[model samples]
Target: MTTTTTLEPVRGPFVWRGDQLSGTDEWIFRLSGDQIAELEDAGRRFVADDPDLRFVTAAEYPLPVCADAVRVFGADLDSGRGFVLIRGLRMDGYDDTLAAAIFYLLALHLGEPMRQNLLGDVLDHIVGVSDKKYLEGGLPSRTRDKLPFHSDSSDAVALMCLRPPASGGLSSLVSGATVYNEVLARRPDLAPLLLEPWHYDWRRQDPNAPADTYTSPIVSWTQGTFSMYAGGDMIESAHRYPGVPPLTAARKELLALVEEITYEPGVALDMDFQPGDIQWLLNYAALHSRTAFVNGPDRAHQRHLLRVWLRRDVDRPLVPRFGKHVVVAAPDARQVGPGDDTGRFRIADAATIRERWGD
Candidate 1:
């Protein structure tokens, strides 16, 4: 795990400042009518089959008309920028099941959908069940708190907005490459610490997970390639577990500095989630966060977004143990269906959540 801390600035299409991108629509891909029609037609047929979504492959749900658009999205995530927003799907006539089907269909074209929870659910509902904070042992996705910029565990993560909040749930993205450049410019000495291993709370991901803590460097530079996995919150939480090493004062300062840079005017690009809008981001290239929001009276009116984590066929080069054990796929990995009992395949109600998380 030892390597020289190369201080040369990482220059690439991925190294972009958010302020510079405010005037550009290049990061957005609005679906054409024909493509929407193709999705609608395929969505209806796929829903009719009622196939287990876990088993559905890209070949099973070919996006002949929209495949090229998806490819462009992958390229944007991997080579151009770190993220892309797909717009132009009207959800007025469709229900949640149909929306989930369409979202999953698009995800299939992007990559192989991975399980998001111990329940082996490929599709995750990002709805606030409570106003709890991550430090309070609550899942960030299930809480209505402002989340710090961080990368999810997978090659890419996608979210489709099913419902927007009444107010304030703006999503923000920061380029890891940009953050690195800033760090090197401001704190070259501490930049190398980011390449050193840091512990993360594995139990926070799943109480029943095999281990309590897992370790990985925040940034990985291999063969001149740069990538990052920002989890400052998780690293902070890991210290609460026994046997996890405590963060030094210098390390703490470095973590705070990294977070501070992410919020700088030009470092973060913010967006409002709209129904049918999908955001796809590469975990290694960028980190993302959300502003706290207010929810409506009941479940029907609550802010809801469907999320999927995907493992692309074409993997990025990373240092050894960079993100090892981050995402524990279903035991079967490829085949998850009803009755196997890995975990719920759909959104769990309050009771179900309480049963599993004891929150």
Candidate 2:
């Protein structure tokens, strides 16, 4: 972890307030009819072969018509707004497998998909299996609790809506650069602290992970490029482990202030996800969260989203300490659990997550 002493204010398109975007729908990219048709054709062809998703390439599942759309989405992530919402996939026609195939195929065009769990699941299902809070031992994505704004462990993240929750469950994003600028404006003292290394619990990432805790600065600035990796919940939890340093009062204040600014008026951009909507976010550029949600009575009608983490082919670089969880490359080829398990393609329930990767 090379030390960066400068705490200069960040600039560029990534530093944008949500208020300025309210009058516009520019952040959203509605798929044209041709794009949807190309995707459906590609999805059906790929699924028919029963190909391993981990090894699939954009070339194998070509998106000739939507290639330009893919490039713009990728550009928005790395250079422009740091997020994009793509609407217009008609969910009624897609079965679970076809939906997964289309989502995975789109992800391949933007970046290389990475495993999200010990099961080497390149695609993961985000569904609430229990009502417990993450702090109360439930997996964050597997619970109905409200998640605080935080960065995921990846260069880019994509979530395709399979079913929106019956009520609530609004998705929100705050620009990491915007948050940083605001923090600097308010508390110049605390801004510098964000550039210092902080401990994060690694155990929650995977049961088979090699380490217990990892260290990284909340924000990284290298040669005028700005990026951030933050999860205050994980940082606080890491302190519970032996040998990890405890957070000082100043550090705690800094974390709390950061969260406070995220919720300030005109700061966070919130979205109501519809079925077939896909959201692409550059993790380092934005911190994302979800409101608590309700579900239908049965499993089939419940809220579900397919999520994939990707390592994009972008020029942005960060501090060396940033990646303890994000996989920059695909791991060695491996099989999922026993033959009965389908957790790799889609995690149907929390029991499968726990059984495949211990909590």
Candidate 3:
């Protein structure tokens, strides 16, 4: 990231502790009865015309009550604490078509959709897709393996719970600013290193991209905003390529410290997901992780999640390196669904789903 003469102090709420957020209702935005009714009624109307359920602009689905809620949530994610959990949508036994439409339309109140991958997939699933048998820096969501804490390649990321595992699917999130402060005070030498740019491999994910790799600082600061871009798996994968610089022993020690503090008590807020719960996190200010879990009997009982990547085009100013592999979907692009493989876009379709996640 390019440096600037003026540095901005981290905001107060951005310095939150896991206990503080986890124990309080302040961080949660539960839907009220009226709000829920309004959402379902609108969804019923949408179902009549948008049978295909294509991605619609916010104007296409207005939520008068939800508008203020979405705006406040966006402000909290963008400028306040970097995350929020919305509970109580009650998706059980409803019309599947209308249910999905409601979820999509309600989330639009957060922001316009951002492309999640090079193939222009705005929607993603979080299961163990990155099987432990094969290790790669890219596409961690594919394997059921435990993902290291890291920031995704988006302005904001939203994950909705459709199912939970029998055990061990806990999630942890920490403020990037807190980590920065800790490093600055304890390991000043490492602080400078974090700002330096470095490479991360991409062969395991988007093999068709312009190059097999991309570079960015493990921790970057631009336009007075602090963002972390570190992912252990990807960083290690970059070392496999001959062109990437080898991580020095000292740097290795520094990275170890970072990993340690990421999950250190009181630093990261850990929360278990509830069915119909939606977590919206600011990609720039948060680093998150998930614990490994065993799959249940079959796909029917497997842990499942629906994820959406969002972009408020102008709200967050990022470093130039972040723009390197950014891919925008065509305005004409439509949303793809489970089992629907029109090849309209490269997505997690029925065939690939069974093949990768298991039959």
Candidate 4:
């Protein structure tokens, strides 16, 4: 679906680089000791009622302190700066299940969780599973591979650290606004091209999904609000479909410029994660990536994170193409799953995750 109305050039004000972002703690929230206690107590009660619980259920009983933070965080994710980090959760004695429960609990207040894959997974385990079989083609989340700068299929994407890798796995985040600003400065002709729609691969889609591909643009703006939906990996893979329009020379150049800008020093902020750290990025305004990680000789030291993709009650205005880019959660949907299945995400241990899916 394309718009026929001629739109003017968009030059938004949120554009910014790492030098301007990394120096400030305005985006960081360090939990106080009282808040930590509040969370631990909440987890105890939650697990008692249901040891294996999802966020939707845990959210029934709220932590007053966390409730306040989630309110402000929701605002920031949409308007202010577009990213926030929650710190100081003591991870020393917590189990993966409990930590995930707490993380998911906080996320419920931010927005409803979206299914992360066609398997109908609501909660995602960001750990490399033994299955590398799907990586040859599909957008499988279980891998040690590096992720290109991209956004997820939701209004906001979140991850909570469970284990720190022995090496690598640092997160690199770049602002779409910053990249757009740079493009406007260097190649004004490319600015408008970014507004045009391009098809994306449906690798993460289940066999039961409505389509094998979807269309969207890298940047979208309404009035003064700016939104972006880019997944370099997915865009490149879309070309495999003969019907999808190929990237023209100018489009290719724009893609290359995005890659270069995301990697250039001082442009993207690279963060080394701690076990208790939780990161949330506004999908529209931020693009993030991760380096390939290595596990220590001891399997216990392997890296892992819990991931959640959310759709807020309040979200930015989107281009017509956005319908294909984001998956909206149903109000009565009790469990998070794909359009075709009843799947429950189960965390087996700190090192492994188990989910029910029929391949």
Backbone clashes for every candidate come to 1, 0, 9, 1
Write model 4 residue lDDT over 1-81, tens digit each, in one string: 122344443344346678777888777889989889888888666555553333444347677877787777777787777
lDDT of each: 0.80, 0.79, 0.68, 0.72
Better of 3 and 4 by lDDT: 4
Q: Which residue runs of candidate 3 sit more than 4 Å off their true CA positions? A: 1-11, 51-55, 117-120, 128-139, 298-300, 323-325, 328-359
> Tens-digit lDDT track for model 1 on 75-184?
99888887999999979987777777788888888888877765666777787776567568677778878888888888889998988887889999999989988888
Give the alpha carbon lDDT tens digit for every residue of 280-317 in model 2: 99998999999888888876557788888888767777
For model 4, the run of ten residues with the poorest summed lDDT: 1-10
Return the TM-score for each candidate structure: 0.91, 0.90, 0.84, 0.87
Candidates 2 and 3 compared: the better one by lDDT is 2
Which regions of candidate 2 deviate over 4 angstroms? Answer: 1-6, 298-301, 325-359
Poorest stretch of ten by lDDT in candidate 1: 347-356
Quote the lDDT for 40 in model 1: 88
Q: Give the lDDT of residue 140 in candidate 4.
A: 43
Ranking by lDDT: 1, 2, 4, 3
TM-score pick, better of 1 and 2: 1
Q: How accurate is candidate 3 locally (lDDT)?
A: 0.68
Clashing pairs in 4: 120-338
Clashing pairs in 1: 119-343
Model 1 scores what on Cα lDDT? Answer: 0.80
lDDT assessment of candidate 4: 0.72
